[model samples]
Target: MKKYILDLPEFILVALSAYWFLENYIGTNHFNPYAFIVFAMLLLQIYFKNKYVGFLLAWFISLFSLYMVLAVISEFRDFPTLISEGALKLLAFGLGFCFLAMGSAVLMFYKYFPKVFPARF
Candidate 1:
């Protein structure tokens, strides 16, 4: 029998982080309906413990998150409007959102496609 909570794959970890980041980044409740699908697949990956399946989910999430970030930027010229209050905080939050999306994409590519990153530390 295996442990209840074993170490997840690097891609899974990254995907999960990106998922959580997106959860917090979104302003409205239930704004993204597809996020629920990603969350469910993540749960499936955890249950099955299949690296390949996890990789597929992670890749899909990374691409989707990148697409979302790009789409938002193209649609909105400003960060949730140029609010005079807490502008710095909003900027920081926006930067974090972009960074997480980009990080997910870069890590997914580097770790899986090119195998630039080692499988395990």
Candidate 2:
């Protein structure tokens, strides 16, 4: 068990990170609706003393969090138009709407996908 957990394949970690990043990019969410699957699987792994699974989950979560931080920075720097007081009121509204959608998507993904993560971890 230690061997499996300590020697996790790099490809799998990359794959999970890429999946999460791509999913977020397409929908403005920091994570996908399937992200929770990975999370729950991670918890199970820990309960079962699977180190590899926990590592994988941690890596993916870090990647997802990093991406979210980047997105926030990008939005803040580029959405200045949305911050201007009067002329961009409508634009600000639209941006707010997108933010809400992104937040909801991430929350939903975590809520739903944690159960889907495989026990192999």
Candidate 3:
């Protein structure tokens, strides 16, 4: 019970990574190499139980989420303009939610499982 609670954040991170990978693979017409790389790194951590791999995966997720948030904010600065455009509004909302979810998961891991993250040499 206590162990499961502690591991919840890792489970969430894995789920989110899988979802994002599938979203990129099937949601878009073009294949995204970066998404594939993320998915692969996450799989390595999940199957190998490699602490260094987990650290690298978490670092990548955090950085990517930050980048996504900044890119979305810069692109969708005009909220009123997006609201007027039906599909664009929906797209913006979806992207924002994805980035927020990823960001929150990374934060949770950092706060609760700090030791799991490896230090850069």
lDDT-wise, the better of 2 and 3 is: 3
Q: Highest lDDT: give the candidate number.
A: 3
Where model 3 places Cα greater than 4 Å from the true spot, the runs are 78-121
The TM-score leader among the candidates is 3
RMSD to native, candidate 3: 4.6
TM-score-superior candidate, 2 or 3: 3
| lDDT (Cα, tens digit) per residue for candidate 3, span 1-121 | 8756645655666676677778877888667786677667655655665655665666666777777767776676656565568547656785866666576557545644556645767
Instruction: Please provide, for model 1 over 10-118, each residue's C-alpha lDDT reduced to its tens digit, 9 standing for 90 to 100.
Output: 4444475557647755754444555555566656655665656645655776776677666555545564665545555555565566566556545544434533334
lDDT assessment of candidate 1 = 0.55
- For candidate 2, write residues 8-114 as lDDT tens digits: 43224344435555768667856664655654564455357444554445555545655665565565667546566643554455454444434433433443346
| TM-score of each candidate structure, all chains considered together | 0.49, 0.36, 0.63
lDDT of each: 0.55, 0.49, 0.64
TM-score between candidate 2 and the true structure: 0.36
Q: What is the lDDT of residue 96 in candidate 2?
A: 49
Full ranking by TM-score: 3, 1, 2
Q: Show where candidate 1 strays beyond 4 Å.
A: 1-32, 75-91, 101-121
Clashes of 2: 7
